[model samples]
Target: IVQTYVENTRLIWYRHFCNCTLINGKFIFGYYRLIPSYGLELIVEILLNTRLISISSTRSNTIRKRLHICQPFINKHHFEYREIIDIKTNESIYQLNLVVVSSNKDTTLIRLIENFEREVLKYPNRHQCFTLTILYFYQKNQTINQIYDLIHQLSIKYTSIIRLSIINQNQINYNRGLGRQLASKLFSNKQLLFFLDVDLIFTGQALDNIRQLMIHQLSISSCTVYFPIIFSYFSSMFNVNNRTVIDINSNIGSFSIYGYGNVVVRKQDLDKTGGWEINNHEWGNEDVNLFQRFSESSSECNVFRTVEPGLKHYYHKKMCNGIVNRERQKICYDADGVLLGSQRNMIIIPYGMSSISTIDCSSFEPYDKPISTWKTLVTNLNAAERDYVKSYLGQSLVEQCEEIEGEIDSLLDIWRDYRNETVANCTNPTIHSLAEPPVLRQRLTTEIEFFVKHI
Candidate 1:
């Protein structure tokens, strides 16, 4: 499957490593490999064509191992797995099987699947070392859907590497555990299974990392599962062109530490652990429950976890109405609010402003840091930034500062009353609600927004 795909597509632009420089028609590279031993210009052209050399069409090191927008930026999955060999190296490439779960209402399923094919499978190869299984869950009445037809087409096209399965949904809501179990059973072999979400964009290197970790450390001696932390992108509004929104300069996307669903485990362990627990608890909280089960069960699983920068969860609207419980709703709301825009962009100014002024909305009072470091409109601005702020707020910096000082007096009174109410009725935080609380930042943002708008 991999050889045929590689030959047909010629998309292995990312697999090779070359850190050489071309100077005055002379190839100057540090590393000495069998290729350099050939001593022919034709070899360089061949290497360049196969993407084995680091040289691009412009004769630059395209695959240098520095932080790149193309890399991490996520990889592999499973059940009956297949082995793929590199056509160049003649080495066996690791195969990962993907089990993607989604409901019929997930409108972006088709588009995301297309993205998965384009970004991962067809090229440099996320799917090169991976097999895919789409577990489509649908209500009995809403059985016939376009997703069905699309999956059918995919199954035919990628026959060696793809399978499409459907589960009859008795309830309107998706039972993630049930869907996973159904998919696991469909696997012919006890393959390593990746419980994947429908809306993830992964990289080939990420897949390679996953496969290497599992292939090396995974043992039936004890249960093992790989839980990779995924980076969630900000809203599409901030990225109209959607060109590499990688947070190279500043933190652009939110690193989701609470989300525990996207995971990799063996089929045997999943069965031994009694599969995913049926959670009547929180919405989209199935992964958390599963993780807990893996950690706290009778036969404890040795779960492996690492921050995978390549695994990215793209922005999408959430159905957080009756579906999510109180805690779940808050998480959903937080994710949705973040996707609406980051605090920096969401503080949209009114009237005929620059139409594109950046809001330096700093992080909230870090639970550990001193609150004085907070970036209010008044404090912490350099001289140049202060001048920019003066124009940004459409008022004198000194006058605005003076007005905000007065405004603080009124806000303190409101705060005192709120503090008393909090003292009167605050309770211990629950497990589900105990991660990163946005209370301080939320208030700070509100106050800053109000002051700026009024000014």
Candidate 2:
């Protein structure tokens, strides 16, 4: 039956490695199906073109060592167990099979069987050594049990080749930010970071394409490219001249090829200019800032995009009418409050304006540092530029001091009476209820408008 199935799916079997050519004629026919869906077509295509580099005994230790270096950024499931074949059978199997066997008697078995067949037909050729990592942000309200369930499910589906990790802002030990932080830690040792977004599912030859571009003549040292995720959206957004290469030497420009997320960096050069700043608050424009910093430091930081190999698509929902500014201010205030109250001897700037007129901290406090130190740090600026910022902060400080004094007085009064306790009540439920209706309508309207506007 196995041989017959392999024969029926000749395209997939042809690409599978090993010395199975001689044993092919010794098997029998298996039950069959007549029609297949688009999902099945994708599975077959992905299988025929994708490459998986097997973990050899000699190279396994090297990979394991690299994983250990990322230990600070990784969670418990970041290094997980992969199922090997039984000693007697000597045939390796996926955990998905065990799942199917256990639930064989269920009514949904047929659907499972079809999906399993499709999956089995996918990824027949293996060229690159790939490991899956799942990242989740640690939230105060999130339950550990729920996190464990999510990890377990992904582990089983990906055949225990998956690793799980969490990033928590409160933990000083781990830098809890976004992709750049994760990439900096993970790729410290690796020559290339290849910081792919979480939603990108490897279909086929993605790594191979990376290698080719690196060796290509037009490719520069610090070039990053992307394969398309969604067709029409990508084409319209990129203004596709087809297989066109964009030069982003000026800014950290992004590219959408074949329709997907951008491939962020060429790790070696990115590290030299400095990895992501651990100081940036909850994600908004951090990528742009990083790109600007890189461009200012190095001439090689360029972006070149290309088409996706097998037309893979990914989608993620975005925020809608959510109070992003309010949340950012809350985080900044909390961070400042904690820093001021902590025993750490470092000079804590409870409130300070950014060098570029952006808000760095929640409030502006006068710096007690030496004039010489401030002058040195604010290099590349004229004497007048320095004086202007200092003068502005001095005036702002007086206003902030008055507000703080009022707040202190108010708190003292609240301690005397219980009325202020009402202000501490939870606001999440109300915020969520208010966010839902408009958010749904807005998303639908935006998607439709995007189509209408483009077409």
lDDT (Cα) of model 2: 0.34
Candidate 2: lDDT of 51? 28
Best candidate, lDDT:
1
| Per-residue lDDT of model 1, residues 1-455, tens digit only | 22233343333322343233322121111111233443312111111122223345544332211111111211234235545433321222235678887876456678667766765557644445677788777777774657777767877877766787766667535677767777888664447777777878777677767876776555333556788878888655444224574452122476666678798887877877677766553456667767766754244556666678888887776666665367777666655655544443323321111223333434322222223322343354445334444444346544655554455445445545555565567675343223233564466446656765654
Candidate 1 residue 157 C-alpha distance from true site, Å: 3.1
The top-ranked prediction according to TM-score is: 1
lDDT of 2 at 413: 52
Q: Cα deviation of 330 in candidate 2 (Å)?
A: 20
What 10-residue stretch in candidate 1 is worst by lDDT? 64-73
